[model samples]
Target chain A: MSNFPPAGVFLVGALLLPLVPRRVRAVALLMPPVASLVLLWILEPGQTLTVPFLDFQLLLTRVDRLSLAFGYVFVIVTFLGGVYGLHLKDVGQQVAALLYSGSALGVVFAGDLFTLFVFWEVMAVASVYLIWARGTKRSRQAGYRYLFVHMAGGSLLLAGALIHYNATGSLLFEPMKGGLGATLILVSFAINAAIPPLHAWLPDAYPQGTVTGSVFLSAFTTKAAVYALARGFAGWEVLVWAGTAMAVYGVVYAVLENDIRGILAYHIVSQVGYMVAGVGLGTEVAINGTTAHAFTHILYKGLLFMGAGTVLYATGRSKLTELGGLWRALPLALGLYMVGAFSISGFPLFSGFVSKSMTVYAAEVDHRGLVVLLLNLASVGTFLHTGLKLPYFTWFGPSRPAAPQTRVPWNMYAGMGLAAAINIAIGLYPGLLYELLPFPVDYRPYTFAHVSETLQLLLFTGLGFWLLIKMLKGEPIITLDTDWFYRRPARLVYVIAVVYPSHLFATTERIALRLVQSLVSASRDPIAALNAATVTLFGRYPDGRMPRRRHNTGDYDPDRYRLPVGVMGLVILALFVALMLWILLAR
Target chain B: MKSTWLVLVVVTLVLTVSGDILTRKGEYGQWWYPVPGFFALLGLLGCMAIVVVSKLLGRYWLQRREDYYGDSGAGE
Candidate 1:
């Protein structure tokens, strides 16, 4: 009832959107970003409130530097995404993206674990409809897998929260000493963030989404999980290695992928790796890096998805092998894509360089040698695939006969341009991003030595790629990932498991059918004979019952067959005995 | 695929062996010493083996294709 709009605003909009005409839904979608901004400006910093009689309390909103920076970037992303997706046919998608993104923002501002969990599940359930909206069977199947993984993660989080409550006797979201409960919570975040070995869901779901749906999907789930990790486990040392593995793992798979959207999906896992590693470093500088990198990544990644979305919308193609020489027609998209590529590659004077250097610097200062080395290698791989290969193959490579030659529309350009401008602005003035971090900033990113070293590393990595391409003989086919573990073998297992029991039941049913048919055929003539005899004998009696006739032995009455009570009672007793036996055997 | 499986197996075995050797209890903080270093080296070596084997075997089996789903379209 307060002036502040409740989280229900988003949920209601999502449910009501499809009921509205398509034309009006586009304008109505603007509510989320506007509402998010108003809430941001109105909410004071260092705020806390607990409503009585509720296990979950509203953490109205927190406007610290970190939350403010993330909130602003998320709102901007949602706006650009709205413009980008204006041509979408489905209102369900537009509404879901808004609600999903807003709920994610809600989590970032949440001051307690209970409020965060509430928003967390909302984001998961709301965002998945984007994947399902693709209208492809592959996408539907992928959506199922996506839902299962997320619901599992949610259950783990809920269980961990209950355990944590028992251990700490409080619902406040604070850092915990590592144990079974804390580890469970961390694993929950790790699964969503696409941590290695459990990281199959990102590539599985994102590529199958509708062109614009992928753009919105890219921004929320994993990054929100990263925000939660930073909030809850900023200093945990293990995430350094976990993050580094994801960084390298994603890049390796990306280099082998032919699907343009798949490449971006894998890169999501890799980019978040930087933030995860930064969190593990557990210093103020590293935390700043996590926040800044997440902010910049959203812009650049959204830009990249926007670019891919343009290709899909215009030509109906997202595979690299099927797309080429697009720069000739879609020059705006190509240029916008390059801006995103440069930002992601951490090139000098781009968003990535400005943000990522903080983490590298923190790692060096902290003396995490192996983690530093893996991240460095991953940076090279990142450039090879996303920065260079994606643009090289999609826009500038040999022209394909099937490639689309149409120019993209103006709204698409506007979306990409907004994101590109933000990338460059953040790169040119890192302080703008630095001021909005969760903590005060004392670090500098533009020192001569820092800039020089970054250039040297990138230059050498570029050289390595050149030499490897020239010297090493490697295949260009897409490499299989852990997804095949479930998508193939596990799917086969599911089929066998479901089909096997059903197959046995089918056999039993056939036998039962045959037995009943034979029994029916055998009893037909005898039943007719018995009917004739009963009618003749019963007609002689006043009542419709025949008088009892003595049996051949003259001891028993023959009228018992007409007494259905005796026959039915005997049948009931037999069935009860059989059912009891079956239960005993089952036990 | 065979090579990848081989690498996975070898690295897991080496890690189990080394974890037994390296892992120990600590009085203050949980302590892990350098015995896992051997396992890490083995893993790096395994990665190399996988890259090499995948490269070699891919020449015969991995033909680039137009449809990755390998059917007219994917079954949902």
Candidate 2:
């Protein structure tokens, strides 16, 4: 029942997840929550235990309200995602999910940044295999990009940890004053949260992952970063802008995407924006908003992805262009997905409206008028894309001729139904959500003004969408985003500037080698020499010039030796190399 | 092209003006920046206006094919 034992149990379960016999993988899936239940029930708040390391004692777990709240949600998500992924059949993916989710759980409960970073990097390395599990060339490329981005984040996190340790001479994960160390840690966490410029990977990788794999991917990384941000940099104030930037950025990009999964992927970042801005405000209300939003976000986002995943599995299509008119056949899935979409758009009587408004409410109380206003606009934008575009394009648009209406498995429906029910349950009753909040809860959500305003914001946004559709007649297509800056023209520049030159240099080297071989062969051939003599020495007399040039042995005369074309080519090559080296030396 | 840029410039100006107005309250003819909230509002309004107008203008410029570059899985 000790903290070390729980860690050991979870670690062992993760290690054994893939090694188990294929027939029993489903049974093995239940191991994670059991370990979680043990940890949760055994470790009381304020309980501390240490494992002896070389010169210091490593605190295995420090149970607190913040850590406990995150731990509880992660455990629940693991169970739900596992149930959704039951049909995955890929043992490697199952094990990776377990280990990756377990490591994230370890991070929140960790007493220090060192423990957090260890699990942080583990989650990064373990999760990429999920992307690779798709077994396509695109998936491979996405996996590689995913690896580089997360590894860069890990390095930044390590650097921040070292800087913080040096500054405070302690590794405890607590609030730090603004400095290079703090900024490094914050930026590092933001990258994982999929902040702009670095955010392309979220959509790129998540959509390419296996149908079930995306469910797990959606919940962990951003939420873990939120936990870290809450732990280390709460009330720092800069997060408000960062969070706001991300929220809007996500909505714009989501509006532009055609892939259903990609649309959901962008919304993940958008929803997290509210949390980041809330935490940045750093009041009791703000922090509570962040935690509450995180809890609700995990459920609704997972539900959305699961719905998209079901479509992908049943139809073998995910792009909006190839889908429509499934509302009749997959009514259960479509209905569940709509709950998720409504919750995300912050509609009245849904989870998003309750949780998202809390952040805006906090901003208003702090007299943060601008934050409140922008967040409201983002709420409207969320309504436009997720609320309207996602469900409309997928289930109600112009129908594809042969779209499938196959029934999804029972467990998948069970998982989505469970999450959607909770989403609605929380929306109708904020008290349940409030009790789970890490901080003391005093905020109310059922006021008449709040309800009316939320309805107005969402309805007006829907009206704008209708107006745009009527006036401009915009067709649904995959609009390019920040990825274009890196994927297209910039990628072209990289190829020309880097790959093209290297390829050219390689070709030139091959040509030079061929030219040298031709020269060496020509020097050894008498007939070739005579032919060369006619062209180079005499210009018109071949027989007479060769007779006059005949030496004692087979052709050792330097005068008879006219430079072959191949030799001239080699000379040109040498000159070019020398010039290149000279230029390099000069520089 | 010219009209799109003009629209973008106008939106940027509107956003900047709104940002300034919100950041500064009419407090005895004195003006100051209202730090994080001001920038957050700027970002939000900028994103929304960009979405609405872009959708309007994208109708003119952004042409996409039903299956322009079908899933070729750009690879070796």
Candidate 3:
């Protein structure tokens, strides 16, 4: 484990993927994540593999409890993603997935800001290809938007990291005190965490990615941001409110969304809000809850995306309006998806129950009543959308008999089943997750009171869903989001500022060139040039006569100003001498 | 679907009743424990609020045609 960076396994696997035989590629893809997971468990906690980078010591592997926890889950999700993508024939997506997952792991274990920044950019560049590999015109455009947003985020992170280093004179990744640098760093992390109004990219791009690629996309990027926040800006009070707002904001948008993946993408914003709030609360249990939630969110969210992906793989549709009666065609997927749904809604005996409740509980203990209320409200909304509404409409709503049931790949089910099983296992035996948390486990999730209270909440939310079933029906319309502000205006601005100006300059240059050419040709014979200039300036010939036209009234013959070559030379030399004398006298 | 509904109702009844008997602990325990089906009411109202708020947003602000951003070539 000390021999090299753990992420190196995946990086090397990505490089070797193209050379491998097609028959063996799938198996080759699975090896790196497994190897990285093994390396994660074997590596000891502390900074290792330091190298001199300019004025700083680059700590490539910081094997602390927090990083290790993130590493464990990242490798697990990568393996699951590899299994889910086994059927894909696109080599570009395969390599991109490997690099993307590898870079996320690099961010997890990065000990210094510099190492983190490098991996941050690699994650952005690598993940955008996953969106592009969907190979749709819309996906191509969405990928560009995704890349631009992330590049902006990366620039902010770089700027913040440099300023932070300048202020502290150290590059070690640690908790930051309040200042412009810290605020900038926090804003950068907030962007990746998908806090509104910086959020729209996740919902914009994730749905546009390939099925398996969306699964990977959902797991890595924001979770890495949560890790960065937990490591760097824990206990910042502002995050508490921002995160609370995000929790409610995400579900509200998700409620109005028609696309299956769009709803889930927004819910990612909602779920991550729990972790951000926990980090902001800054209690031991809160941090513990944040880590636990991130770990479970990866599994359950990946499962949800996988479930939706399977639907997409089969029916070639992801909108709720087009999908129905999938429970019959994809019974296995329906059951597995419900597990994720229930888990995310914080139903009893599921991963979300054990993880998400801790954050709310921490807030209550801290006497942050408003935060508690907001988190609880968000939970109710979570159940309303993901747990009840999504499953209801996608699986059991109006039948679509015209749609063919395409065969889903076995590895897809295998991946989802594995994630579902883990979710249940962790939910039931939270100690399995608790021991991996950065802080000690003191809170219990399974008291009779908690169990009963949570059940009552979820069941009644189910009751609400049933009551509002008619109103909850999906429509074939899009709900404008913050992305609209950019999607429409940004294109207009780009055309005007960038595209139109360049085109205008090109046209102007062409006209200018033509005018210059005519001037140069006229200057070749100075007497004709002088005659034309005089005619244009004075509307008469140099001889005080109207310019004589040939057959066409406006056309003039060059013979009208024809002079001996010697006389033309003499005229040009005399003008030059007169200009030189004027310049000499003026000086 | 009927059986699922039946199971949900039964579960909700059992939990609400059992919650009445269970000893509550920690912050807000007094307020929450004394109120029968407190979380249930909260969940119900919360879900309703979400639907109402989202519907209002959709109707007034957020909703748009399927081609609201225009065709795929619009931005291009």
lDDT per residue (tens digit) for residues A1-587 in model 1: 22243344555666777778877787677676777677666655555444543655555554466667777777878888888876666777887897898788777776666777778888888888999998887788789889888898888988888888888877777777877778888989898899988889899889888878888889988888888898889899898888888888787677556678888988999889999999888898898888888999999999999998888878887777777787777888888898998899888899999888788777877867677667766776677677767777777766786456465667778879988998999999988888778888888888654554455445444444444542232223555566666665765686789888899999999999999985675476554445445555664233354545532211223474477677889999999999999999999
lDDT of 1: 0.74
Instruction: Give a tens-digit lDDT track for model 2, residues A1-587.
Output: 46553445557887887778887786678777767776776677788777777766777688877777777778888888888876668888888888888888877877777787888998998889888998888788778878888888889988988998888788777887867777888888888888776677798789888888889999998898898888888998778888988887787666667778987898888888999998889988899899888988998899999999988887877877778777776788888888998998777788977888888888888877667766777777777777777777677777775367565788899889888988999899988788878788887887655664565456546545655543322245656555555556656787889999999999999999999987787767866656666656665345454344444223444555577778889999999999999999999
What pairs collide in candidate 1?
Answer: A66-A437, A66-A438
Best by DockQ: 3
Q: Kindly give the stretch of ten consecutive residues in candidate 1 chain A with the minimal lDDT sum.
A: A549-558
Q: What digit string (tens of lDDT, one per residue) describes model 3 on residues B1-76?
A: 9999888797766768566556555556434546666777888888898998899989998898887776533332
Candidate rank order under TM-score? 3, 2, 1
Q: Rank the candidates by lDDT, best first.
A: 3, 2, 1
By lDDT, the best candidate is 3
Query: What's the true lDDT of residue A219 in model 3?
Result: 93
Q: Sort by DockQ, best first.
A: 3, 2, 1
**Residues A1-587, model 3: lDDT tens digits:** 36378878889999999999987787789999988887887887774888887767899887888989999999998988888878888888899999999999999888889899999999999999999988888899889989999999999999998898889987888999877777878888888999999998999999989998999899999999999999998998888888899999999999898889999999999999999999898889999989999999999999999999999989888889888887878899989999999999998889999999988888888887778878888999998999888888888888775264689989999999999999999988999999999877899999777787787788878888888888898988888877888898977998899999999999999999999998887767666667677777888767787755632323446665577788989999999999999999999
